[model samples]
Target: MSDLIELRDRMRAFTEERDWAQFHDPKSLILALVGEVGELAELFQWLPADSAAARVQDEPLRSRVGEEMADVLLYLVRLADVLEIDLGDAAMRKLSGSASRFPPDDVRGQAPEKA
Candidate 1:
């Protein structure tokens, strides 16, 4: 099975074991995902944007960042599964759409146009 599918299954089992499936509706999952993203953002909120990458590489911060990111991914996967959305396919299609909208030869080193 794909890693994403495995992860989704694991998350499902986790929720099921805790009898949390009732609370895993799309809206609640989305809110949980957003809260996780906020936690991740909070870790970098006071850092110099340019140094943020290096800052997260340190030992304690690195572990903290990883945990926050994993939380975000878990909630996102749970949300996608609840919604019956194919996250991998959706990601590929979105990437392709973005590529077509901003061809590299034409838009290199520039911000994407407002859609």
Candidate 2:
């Protein structure tokens, strides 16, 4: 099975074991994901832009950032699982659509326009 499917199964089992399925609805999982992203953002909120990248590469901060990112991924996977969506396939289609919309020859080195 794909890694995403394996992760989804693991997360589902974890939630089931915790009796947390009631709280794993789409809205709740999305909200949890946002909170995790906020936590991840908080790590860089006060950093100097020039040093931000380097700082996250260091000791404790790197681990913290990784944990927060993992949280975000887990919540997102749980959300997709609950919604019966294939996260990887959806991501691939979205990426393919974007590639067609923003051809490299046409949009290279340029920021994408707001829809």
Point to the candidate with the largest TM-score.
1
State, as a TM-score between 0 and 1, how close model 1 is to the true structure: 0.95
Cα error, candidate 2, residue 70 (Å):
0.1
The 0-to-1 C-alpha lDDT of every candidate, in the order given, reads 0.92, 0.93
**Structure candidate 1, residue pairs in collision:** none
Candidate 1's C-alpha lDDT? 0.92
TM-score of each: 0.95, 0.95
Q: Report the poorest 10 consecutive residues by lDDT, candidate 2.
A: 106-115
Q: Write the per-residue lDDT of candidate 2 for residues 24-90, one digit (tens) a residue.
A: 8788888989999999999999999999999999999999999999999999999999999999999
lDDT of 1 by residue, 3-96 (tens): 9999999999999999999999888998899999999999999999999999888989999999999999999999999999999889989999
Candidate 2: list runs displaced more than 4 Å: none
lDDT of 2: 0.93
| Total residue pair clashes for candidate 2 | 0
